[model samples]
Target: MPHTYLVFVWHMHQPFYKDLATGEYQLPWTRMHALKDYYGMVEMLEEFPSIRQTFNLVPSMMVQIEEYAKGEALDPFLHRALKPAEELTDSEQEFILKYFFQANPSRMVYRYSRYGELYDAWRAAEGNVERLRRSLGAPGMRDLQVLSQLAWFDEIFQENDPEVRQLNEKGRDFTLEDQALMGRKQLEIIGHVLPAYRRMALKGQVELSVTPYYHPILPLLCDSNIALQSHPGVPLPRRFQYPGDARLQVHKALDYAEEKLGFRPQGMWPSEGSVSDEVLALAYDEGVRWMATDNGVLGATLSSLAGVRETYRPYVWKQDGREMRMIFRDHFLSDLIGFVYSRMDARAAAHHFLDRIRENARVLHNEGRDAMVPVILDGENAWEHFDHNGRPFLKELYRLISEDPGLSAVTVSEALERIPATELPRIHPGSWINANYDIWIGAEEDNQAWEYLLDARQTYDRVVNGPEGAALSEAGKAMALEELLIAEGSDWCWWYGPQHHSENRPEFDKLFRDHLAHVYRALELSPPEHLSRTILRIATPAYQQPPSGLISPRIDGEISSYFEWMGSGIYSPDHRQGAMHGRDNAVREVRYGSDGQKLFLRVDLEQQKPGALAGLEVRVIVKSVRHESELHATLLENGAKGTVVRSTRKRTLGAEVSCAYSQIFEMSVDLLSMGGRSAEMIQLQMSLWRDGLPLEAAPAQGWLELVPSEPSDWE
Candidate 1:
């Protein structure tokens, strides 16, 4: 029977924990989980040897994994996870023994009885861990190794970690030794598993794909102003040309993939499924035969494809008189596995997915048309949440597709190979994000943040394009350009959501500033004060303390509710002790006083290990109840003095510092001064920073009430 459906998914992503400066990896759990999830998925492909899938191994992530596979930086992090086993009590020993007895494939008959004796000796000592340790000391390294291997099975998926997430932000550095270790791991993975992927693609078992370098929101990188149009409250940074920069990003992806992967990818998954006509034209000019975006983009850009009103079908997109095949992803189906399905049983989820494809195929056949359903999502993230480490679901899904007569699977490249390019219409400029740039640029908090970014961008542009521009060597110029490009990614700005406006805002500011600073330094500019002045002008006030007593977190009154995982450590409330890699966590206390117009907020952040102190930042934002006329103050400070007190900065203007004791930092605000009389609500954020940058920060908010000011209320 002719194939009625084509299942194509391309997993694209970079580990946010990979530190750019020293190239060190902070989150070992992400790597450990990703390895199991991805490897398990690949192994499942064995059941349906003929089943095809596309895997886009980001160059950066590929590098990090290779380093771990070769005993580089990650070996130590792995060592740390294994260290806890040394202190296990009697009950813990029993737990380990029972768990691994069912796990290890190479258990010696005598070793089983040996483990039982150790278990018995430890249990006989009750809860005395020293005795247990002494008893296990004989087995020592061997036992620890077993425990280390077993830790991988703990089944807790690592999500956004605040510590690791902060490292991804600007101005943070990983030590050199750490970087070397991570680099070695990347090279190792390249030598080891990457080859398996290459061989699979070469053998037609899978297809390989690639994304733009640094995985930026291409449209925003082209023109920061796109945000101003969509987000009314958000201000545009210095104006940037669109089509020109877009071209650079597209060409860069093609060149990198062709050079590293041995063949030009037939199709590209624009970073984050971000797309527009300008983006598509750039892709086609650079030889991208096809690309895919979220179905929502197609629904907006073209009302219908191939006479089909819906965007779920694969169709050709025309841009600038050139045409390329485009596939609109069924985000609901794809993300079901990435985010939602993790809560379900692997078998049930797999069955449900297979059934959907079957139903789609049957319907298409009944209607007399071919059904090309694009199932696209992140490869590593989805499996981390799945049961059996996503093994059963993946295997079942691939097997059902490969063996079932009703459906067939093909890699994106294979499908694109079957279609020929034709002339296309003029494409528009936009992204899958909010149908415009509002998510990145629209918001009072976002606009204020960009005002500072614009100042910094202009400062850097002047230095680079000035007389110093002529004297720089070719390499220096190239480095400056690349640094600016990397710094311009849109992820930092879009992190503003709900009341969390200042969360990732500072990092956005610092990166834009740092790149500009690099340009000034390279050009022999003097007195860093010029840059500092610009930063402070746009800097918001810091909070007096971190949030405390976070026995439970509620969002919109729902216990432990989490909506977005942009920058704050991917704190999945269900997992205790696991940090959100590349995200931060702060607990907050909100109390309203005197008819509701007066507000008090306390933010508390638990410290990381000693000597990791960078500093803390606090921003208090007051908005009119109607969500208009916003005013804010930002304060930055170093050290953790657990007390609520105010201080002034002699060297800086408008600097009023407040701090609190007991791990709970408080900031008090009266709405009357900042349009509070006419406004109905208020928002405050306190973010922790390392080296003058913001980490995971959540907003605390409340409605305003009319009240008389106490005699104590004056600046």
Candidate 2:
């Protein structure tokens, strides 16, 4: 039996982070991601010549790239984007010299013609930047052309350039501006890199698609209330009717794709395969004929709509009883490649992927329906894990698929045109994250966060709905909208994971409160006197301080402070762990608590702790379950800092401190290399240590809730 396997990969993303005022990106990961994967994948297709795939470029990411394309001095922007390393390793410095245009022959030749050396020499000299600055005078679109030309030269070192080393350095500190600039550069590079794809796409060799701006979870974006309830403490990054925002995102993204690629994309890939009826309607409003979600969403939808067996293939999603040609990705296979195949040899993995599709096609043939397999996944990050940098695996997969007569590949848009509008299913409101929504919800800490958000949401509604809110001016409305957008960020809730609260809970609370405060002010509402001071207290630094009963250890960087009360009106260290994670170079900052039952420990991570492990392990005897016990860990590192509870047990308070350690390698050293369930368990334990000691122990005046895990044997 012959079957056409349509492998469609919809790459969806947003700027890693956005500036509050300018809406500009603050992190380059998004743009760098496009350059490394989105553009790379498109360009790679030139080799297959016949292979086709779908991509969804978010408008927000494109906007940043566009800014790069319009820059006056590419070099300065590039330098700003790629923050200079504070202390580069010898190897890193060598790579910089080896790959940079000034030192590397390949890069110099690729970027410059005969003048490459002159440009390189100018770049090498401190005065040269000033000279080049004078020569350029002002930044503009033409400067982008010059930069674009020079970027081509950088291809020689694009993969091995020193910038990546800094980006990957988890423990290093980066200034906020540097982080923002890096993000801009990353996007600019992507804009520059995409021309390679635009060339192919222009030649009708590949197909492109667009997604909603910022790549937010569409269903959540459409309705903040849903997110608030499902994931209580999570902050919404933007404010607006989600449906309207989603429509805007899609329209803008599609428009940008058209402008950049010289053609409108035929389909759309909702961010993270996130979807729902509201999202579907927004897609319709945006003129997007097709969208894709994880196969799990489709199956769940089919079970609700038809109560029949569902298959992983392209289908038409209908709204108001109308067909909406939509596609479902074989998430299992897709994840296998994106998550697992990278770990396998290219030949074996590629063959296995093809075999899986072949098996699925055979099954579809029996069912008498043409099967379209969307083998979509991240184009970058996944590649680094592959041997030979994913070249072998990708090349092999392309070779086999293109040459195999039995198999055929088509872009998602083209495939949709071939399929007829059929019976539709109700897609459950969800995303490709955890099925239960625990990733974004269910943590107690998150619940607390949500309580704050709910207040903000309600207040905003009142302001807009009430006389005060109605009094807002156009400028006021815009400012309020900006505040609302920041409030909707998903990072706040996401920081708390797998349990009671995320470490970034405090930030989430602050952001939500601040936004509400702004809305309140815009509406000219005088808080009912009492609430004014309370709101101010929550919104101001008055309510924030270091934890109690902990001593500061001598370290070089910054430290984080965390404290939480679970109804008792007493600060307990255990309850506050989830409020801190990913903070670097921490020593005890301050500790404040009264009763022996309650304690606060403020830790700081300044200089690197000598022989610091990524995490630590502590043990306590498991006493009777009657005793209430909890364990939390904090990291004081770089500029960002926080704390998290590694484990909690009643009567079994003994657990390890689960700090986001400085040495991820040391954390992985114990377990990742081996197999077997018990071994894996042991490895997992090693990776998630609760407590014992810091990588380096220091003594200061802070409180410690150090306790035994079990009760006395005599008792």
Candidate 3:
């Protein structure tokens, strides 16, 4: 038979979010994903007997999930959500209003009626979380509480489980008893997640793999200097070469997965698919049979082979009496499912994917070689943007795959059993992202984070090797070392650079610094004074870039010209910041600038259908220290017409607000008409709406304020 192997590895991971000093889980992602993706991702595999996939479970995430299953995690969101609505304190109520809606507006929130209603109310209040909390009576609060939790339930449970079905069916006016039941069901569901994956592995429907204990970049652990090989001249921190930590992380991951899943993980997916010769040697020594990385690494390692054929096959690194099999993921195919398919119709998307796969298979067959396609991506974070949490798309894709005789879905090990791996003398030193460690290092924030880690590590060594060493028990030193390992995780730096954004980034900074502090606390010593303050140099105020100079762009709802909006201020929605990492990014950014005559605004959206932008209402609000101005327009299908309105805080602006639509949404209003002429400073905010519900808002925190730079500023 002509073989076409499909290797699917769903990389499941989350950072160690706990602060040992306070025993607090700084974030709730692990628990949230457990309820939403972990079990269901594997559980759905049962429907197709012929398909087998790999699930790469990271140890740090596993530990958190286990704690949540036992109801021992001190997650503020979990505790706050379950508390009776009437018993919530002012702060607690405020927390609920702020964080409960940290979800996708189109899918997660709008999928349910009551949740959408509550969210709409919260949005219309315009930052009045406390007022919204007060306005929502006990019944409304209870409904919000129950629905927030329910919105994250697995697709299978939402449809099949009787208790879950009833609560979802009840939909509104939840009771105290209902909240109690909701709490129990959530734990119960989390408890089943691991065992379900184990069952699938045992039944031969799936294979399980493991990453490092704390999901650190193993190459950097071995030698931070290695980063310079992939990215020369990238500024680095003080040398931090800890091969011992890298060895321990790999060894512990295999042991932990064995203890938790009842079998040793045969394959390894290094954190971020990062690999180097040193890291590979460690994995091979730890008894790992095969490991996987991204296509960029493969391309960089073996520049001789052409693109597609070289990418869709396995390879081996044999050097110095050690051998490790490797698979390079098809980054484009993996990203299509991760970032692109969610915006498409399930059937059309699935068929489009199948067509591409078939073409790849045909190409390989003609070349007298079999195709081995490796698709890998984050299992949890991409789903919220998907329809029904990506279940429909997966089902359709899998069904088409199963019906095709030329395609066969297989695990990494099974694929290795059938296809031979090409040999390579050396491996590249980089990660799955752009084939560089720049995401975790190089940038100012990233370099500072590493320096902090180096300082803490040296302090621990000093405590152990110095005069007070012999008196210290080994357990206490080990405890301190464990905290250091937790701090070494790549996730801390993942949020540090200009690359990503999250509403919970402040909490991440606190948790990382707290871990460093506990390294000393565990050793019975005081943490350094510098460690008391945050390593995050700039506090994130929902991210903004100020305008440089005055501009007079034609309001034609198009780019007009590159120079027309060249110096325009960009007010990107905080929610859209993670587009590169697969988060909900419906609208890309809001471009605004002003001239002597009028202030102009443009809304840029992600790729959409012809009529897709029509229904969305683009609303812009401008406020001076003295007055406010508003512009409202309902985009029509032909990109032709919309209703225009002008209003202010005190009274209507009455001036004509010009609105237009084409490739972008553009509007302009005279400054004098909006009361900005004599004002000290002008503040702008913009939002997107559909069906009376707010889809997204730019400058999610604080206003986009500027002093209205003079036209000569550009000169």
Q: Rate the local accuracy (lDDT) of all candidates.
A: 0.49, 0.47, 0.82
List candidate 2 stretches off by more than 4 Å.
22-26, 68-191, 221-266, 304-309, 319-321, 366-369, 419-422, 434-436, 445-454, 457-473, 486-492, 499-715
Query: What is the per-residue lDDT of model 1 for residues 281-316, given as tens digits with 9 covering 90 to 100?
Result: 677788887787776666555544422225435567
Candidate 2 lDDT tens digits, 385-404:
55545667888988898888
Global lDDT for candidate 1?
Answer: 0.49
Candidate scoring better on TM-score of 2 and 3: 3
**Number of backbone clashes in candidate 3:** 0
* Highest TM-score scorer: 3
TM-scores for every candidate against the unseen true structure: 0.59, 0.56, 0.76
Better of 1 and 2 by lDDT: 1
How far in Å is the alpha carbon of 171 misplaced in model 2?
Answer: 23
Ranking by TM-score: 3, 1, 2
Q: What ranking emerges by lDDT with the best candidate at the front?
A: 3, 1, 2
Off by more than 4 A, model 1: 15-20, 26-30, 67-191, 227-238, 242-244, 304-309, 417-430, 444-457, 470-478, 499-715
